[model samples]
Target: MGFDLVSRVRLYKVLERIGCSPKQFDGSPSTPSETNRGVKQGCVQASNLFGIYFAAMLRHAFGGFREVCGDFRLNISLKKTNIMGINTQHPPNIHISNYQLEAVNEFTYLGSVVTNDLSLDTEIDRTGSASATFAELAKRVWENTKLTLTTKILVYKVSILSTLLYGCATWNLYSRQKKRLNIYNLRNQWKMLKIKWYDHITNNEALQQTSIPSIYTLLCQQCLRWLGHVCRMEDGRIPKDLLHGELNQGSRPRG
Candidate 1:
């Protein structure tokens, strides 16, 4: 059942009262005491175990929700509810109203497939396949004698590339992954431009003709732009806090 406006407001109030808030952490103090050092180390460990913390918090939140539902005499559909763990080895066991919720390794949310490993390989492959399918669907546009090359390129960028690059701003990419995406993009560009493999046209030449950046460059730009936005967010924001949170002192991961 759907909640009316009043019930929604009551639910929000209940959550607020139960302390269901976003997590935040500032840098640890620089005190020299042994206790202070231990506290700092514990904080670092907790940060590393994000999956555990997330699952625990979810359990608490759902417990509060159950309480609120009982108070309001509302029935929750256990059959429709499930829990998914991300980047977690052991999935959490959550119970609502004496019914244990099933844990899933993979789930779809907002049209994106998310897996427990938190790797973007599945999303990237699905997006690439969708882009290729879209390209085939628009083959007539690419081959149409009446449409100019510029028009075809515009169509591809608007329809095909947008589908492929959805949610790319938050992707964590490495060199190998970037190379794979770039190769796929280059092949798509060649196909759209009607350049055969035997044409002897290089990837750079194709990019120059299309006036577009490499897929890696484009993703980098988007990620950097998002980073700037998060940095500029208010201090209390979760993204801002996570960006500036206390991190283990070590070399950062290579791109």
Candidate 2:
């Protein structure tokens, strides 16, 4: 297919990933703000966290953006804050907007300057074995990363399935409010969704090849690579250990 057609398809795939439909978003406006829309509590939090992870992951992988979106704004509701157990110490009632600002462009995860003297990641309750808990947490992170990566690819494809899927959703969403439809916001969401969805691809240049990447197979490859390294460390049988140890130290100590 021609590059223009391919790019258009990829754009449609983004709408599907974000639960929007092509029929609903076609010919949409150019600058719809994300803040005006009502989003579910869970989805809002997920999108915020996604911004941070995407920035960090992209930097870690060392990729360049085809285009940069400057005014992309994501609003997260403070009322639904779940510390995963760390909120009591910090007090949910405290206003985060008042504190000093620390911006992490790579990590996108923003935190307010807390005068209350509390660490966000501090452990509050010790209910499980540390090793087991660590293992479980690691597994969960890996799984989530894999799933999100797959979603990103599918969105990038913007294939026929994506178009049909998203067109239906958008049609239904706007069918209710026809007169006051904000085409501008619709288009903006498409742009934001593209950034949100193509995260892993932006990080891994290999993923941005002309052909679509296989999500499941690549995920398995990552899992195997991680597990193999872990197993080698546990068994004390990693080949060329001495060489690696020396190289890691950047020259050997002469006795």
Candidate 3:
């Protein structure tokens, strides 16, 4: 196989490992396919970061680039359609009978391509200490009668509501209490998160210029770059070299 094909297959391998199916992708070799791939990957990247959806939860499966993008794009469209009309009636939601908050909490570990710095207790003022922060949030929770009176109920409610709304929850009560356990869970599962391919390529180029020749070195450098990009709330853009026709004809894909 050619280098470009190998690279594309590697990308497919990465996607496969993350629970994205090759069969469901609909992207073609032409412009339409590429554009759709970009959009579908973009949405999955968004959903991954927000702790709501999982690439693994995709209902259908595919085997190639088109299959991957088409499957995901269709699913995203269905979600949008379901939530479109105001007061639209949705199917009856299943009750959380055997739902343990701990099970769903695994999602918090899968990091997103984007990050939000908003606090749950945004209105409360923190006096610059960890203890102070907790105190303020507690005060705010108390001030909100709905929160205070139903702390227990809020726990279950949020867990259930999040699952119903987005289909996943990791900040649930049982998961919340097991800090060490959940923290560990988050660390281990992060690799399952989608790779920021374009950003990774750019950073790899920079590292190569600096004489960082090893693949391991490039991956480490890119991971740090990825984290910083996430901290700053940025989308992974296509590498300029590839766009400007600098990476040779092969790496740039031709129609």
List residue ranges in candidate 2 displaced over 4 A. Answer: 1-36, 43-70, 74-125, 128-255
Per-residue lDDT of model 3, residues 10-98, tens digit only? 34455667676555356644342442232244586544432222333233344653355444432223211211112334422322233
Q: Compared with the true structure, what per-residue lDDT tens digits does model 1 show for residues 47-152?
A: 4433333334345565587765555544567876778877777898999768899898877775577888888788787665666666576647876878887887
Off by over 4 Å in 3: 1-9, 13-32, 35-130, 143-148, 152-255
RMSD of 2: 24.7
Worst 10 residues of 3 by lDDT: 100-109
Q: What TM-score would each prediction reach against the true structure?
A: 0.69, 0.19, 0.18
lDDT of each: 0.71, 0.34, 0.32
Considering every candidate listed, which one attains the maximal TM-score? 1
Global fold similarity of model 1 (TM-score): 0.69
